[model samples]
Target chain A: MSWRSELQALRDDGFDVLDWLSATEEDDEVVVTACLVRSEDPGSFRLVRSPAPVESVVDMFPSAQWHERETAEMFGVTFEGLNAAPLLLPPDSPAPLRKAQPLPARLSQWPGEVDPAKPRRRQDPPGTPWR
Target chain B: MAMNPRASLELIAENCTSCMLCIRACPVWCLELDAHLEVDESSGRRRSSLALDRFSIDYGTCMMCGLCVDICPFEALEWSSELPPTQFEWRSE
Candidate 1:
């Protein structure tokens, strides 16, 4: 499914609430999943998904900004129109999720325990490790 | 920590991530994110843009399931025992 049309359809359904959006890379494509809940039901939901990155709903749903950023950062899919700077993955790190033999960092969380009070020191430090 | 269900979040200074996840997650969109994030000499983080200006926990409209707390990755936010003293009047709708 085209990413744009699918997202547009979500807009048509009036999915004003964003639940969660995540992505995974296939051999040659990235699949993005966006879940939204109906305002009336709140918890009862609908999910809008696509296997392509060409279509984008970042314009229709302003909140999709972060979703697209993380998707592009981790899965390497281009959101034809989203322009927000990357929110997670380091500014200088190469997107490793796109490689044929992607490194564990692409799928792995920081190696050490995460201390809520301390700075994150376990994530890849940058310099485009896989690029 | 089991907090009072009738609590207000004013003093918690629950800084919004501007990730807008709360707005996205809010069933009522009552949680509004505005542009008040800025440097505060009190807070020492070099980069000091906090999320929304201030979030109102519409006591009448909130659903106390802790979803808001769950979505806040910054830990700048938390629930409190009582509503902090407010200077602005709340909107009546």
Candidate 2:
């Protein structure tokens, strides 16, 4: 079965709800992702993701709510979900399918901490009258 | 028109530079830059529907998640002073 079919089958096996969905476009293609979980198996969950063009598995999951909307705006993927609106974007947005576009400044660049032991370049402390 | 009474709507249009980052970052589809988005006749590229128009925030439906301002590549969005302001000022290298 194809990825969409696999997702539908998984839904049939009681994975009836969608938790969220996200998409990222690469140089070659778009990647659509879905996170699935059910009430019965609260802790256990699975992720369904693939490169576009992705089929709308929205029919199988109602809570796919914002997930489908997000995928549409970020990657221009259409979903059979209720409405494909700017979930994380404005309706008047320009082409969102530019995979090479830089990520939002706040969302880009992971900053890690510096190693503590590597430094000994401390300048003299601020002047105090007592010193 | 109906945004949460609690959320503020402010637009810094000058800083917008006509980039649609705010337009593409709203989760609730509440932001509208009233512009003529047209398809380029020759290139078929989807260009602006209108020229530069003021952006509207539909508060009646807005979730006020701040994602719109967060995704704006330009500093075109003004924050509500009530909330902690996160602003990015661009400086030339």
* Clashing residue pairs in candidate 1 (N, C-alpha, C atoms within 3 angstroms): A4-A55, B14-B77, B16-B51
Best by DockQ: 1
Residue B6 lDDT (model 1): 45
lDDT by residue (tens digit), candidate 1, A9-80: 766787667778878765667777888876777877778667755656666777778887887877767777
Model 2 TM-score on chain A: 0.62
lDDT of 2 by residue, A1-131 (tens): 56689788888888777777887766677777777787697787888878766667656666666667766776676664346766667777754556444435324211111111222322221211122
lDDT of 1 by residue, B1-93 (tens): 776654655324444345555544554334544433456566565665543444454555555556666676766456667654433122222
Q: How much is the lDDT of residue A81 in candidate 1?
A: 67
Output the lDDT of residue B56, model 2.
60
Worst 10 residues of 2 chain A by lDDT: A109-118
Residue B44, candidate 2: Cα error in Å is: 69
